[model samples]
Target: MKQKRFGIDIDGTVTCPTSLIPFINKDFSLNITLDDIKKYDLSEALDIPAERCQDWFNEREPDIYWSSPLAEGAKDVLLKWKEQFQLFFISARRSHLLDLTQKWFETKDILYDRIELIGSHDKIKAAKQHKVDIFFEDKHDNAVSIHEELRIPVLLFNTPYNQDPVPSGVIRVDNWAQAEQWVKAWIDSESFIQQ
Candidate 1:
């Protein structure tokens, strides 16, 4: 049997984007807490026209993705999963971060088949093009959209701002350990039945 294909997100899923928040807060310097950073509506804080904010985000793309640190166990879990599935990173971290993100993966020695860095808020189209079977993501809106449209099973990685209730059929997991076990059990059960 062929191995399943997984579409994984970068920020807040495989890695924590906390570093970017500090940058954003320092640039704004509103004495914001981490929670405030997480809960902040970028549109409101930036207080700019939509197109201008888009431009600003594009300009600051590097500061966001490259500064993040990988989540705990993300490297190990991904390495283990590489043995059972084809891993593809489907991130909304802009095209500029392609080289940086790839270098980050190389440093971690993560063996993924592909890495896609789409612009922010355009993951669903990218995932559809990739034919991703399952996805692990941390963004609530993205998860809901992907799950609703593609009906793909998404393992939601818990995050402060993403604590909104997940729709039915979407699995919510606290950490990568639980995610690894869930995938392993499913694969093992399939193997057993085939035997």
Candidate 2:
């Protein structure tokens, strides 16, 4: 059997979606929780200007990424999958953060076959280049887009900000445990089809 390659997003998928909330609240002096973020744009959620939010993010991106915690159940599942599947981390983080990203992964004890930091939300190109059998993402449009474009299933990690409706190919998983269940079923069905 050929090993499946999974294209996964870093932030909000592997890391907790609310990883930046405390930082945002502290920096902005507003006690807003993850549920308060209705939109993917932090500025919109905070009702602040976009540029100001961008500036803050740029200044604190390293610290934020360095300290972000893994999502619940992510470590166990990913570690198990590492022995069978080819894990490729495709993130919207900039290329300059490769060292920091690798360090973060090491600190978290996560293993990967590859990591691509594309610096933009549009991940279709990277997904295609990696030839991933499936994808995992936290962004709503990104999940829909990667599935629609690549003709592959995309597991969307559910978040308050990504409550928008998704296509049939985009499976919504509330946590890594659910994600593991879905992947097992998908692999079984695919194997059956091949046979």
Candidate 3:
């Protein structure tokens, strides 16, 4: 069977972002918790423009793109998937973080065909442009938007902040190991059998 294209997210989905939370709270002094950051509605922070929040992050942790830790089994699962799919990283990390993100990939030895750093909140447009059949993301808003607008399958990697209600047709998985199995099973099922 022919390989499929996979569009994956960077933050919590690929690399764990927990390590950066402390820096975010310390630098911003917003009394924000990890949950607050995860479910943050940038529009609601009237005192800070959404874009300025990105700047705040850059100022405090310029190397966040490279410093974020990988989730357990992330490297192994991704490397395995790379052999079977055209892996493309679709991240909301600011475009300026590209160099650091690349450095992280190099450090972990994670291979990919392409990496697209989408700084804006809007991810549906990027998914449509890429013709991504399946997306693995941690953000509820992004998953909802992409799945609804493009009718593409989105596997929402579970997180504390996103534990509430989920949009229709979006599947949630606990971790990368389970996610990898779910994806492989779906691809191997008789329903997807090729002629």
Candidate 4:
């Protein structure tokens, strides 16, 4: 049987949702938490001009990604799944960040079968090209669109910024632990069906 592939987003999914909070708070000199991020736009959350926020992010993107922390329980679950599934990480990060991203993964002691830096939020093309059985993401629109377009299950890691309602195929999970539970059950069902 062919190995099932898992398409996962890198940042804000495997990495803690609050990973960028420190940078934002320090650079902008504001006291904010993850709860302050009610939307995906950092500018909107910080009440700053979008252009200024974008400039700041562009300048500090590398440092931000390099210093990101892994989400709790993500390492264990991902490592365990590494034995059973193809871990295909699909990220919105630019292609130039490949080296940095790989180094970051190594620094975190995480393993991946493949990593695709698509530089855009629209991941439908890459996901379809890779033929992933399921997807994991923290972006609300990305999760909903991927599931709806691909007709596959998508686990949306719940966060303050992505509180939007998801479609039926988009399963909202609180953390990596909950995500693993859902994936395990799904895998078992798939095995039974294949058998």
Best-first order by TM-score: 2, 4, 3, 1
Q: Candidate 2, which segments miss by more than 4 Å at Cα?
A: none
Candidate 2 per-residue lDDT over residues 1-195, each given as its tens digit: 899999999999999998998899899999888888999988888899999999999999999999999999999999999999999999999999999999999999999999999999999999999899999999999999999999999999989999999999999999999999999999999999999
Error of 3 at 161 (Å): 1.8
Q: Global lDDT of each model?
A: 0.78, 0.95, 0.78, 0.94
Query: Candidate 1's residue-wise lDDT over 53-131, tens digit each?
Result: 5676678777676666788888889988898788989987768678988988887788899999887766888888888
Quote model 1's TM-score.
0.84
Where in model 4 is the C-alpha error above 4 Å? none
Clashes of 3: 0
lDDT of 3 at 179: 89
**TM-scores vs. true structure, each candidate:** 0.84, 0.99, 0.84, 0.98
Stretch of 10 with least lDDT, candidate 1:
32-41
**Highest-scoring model, lDDT:** 2
Best by TM-score: 2
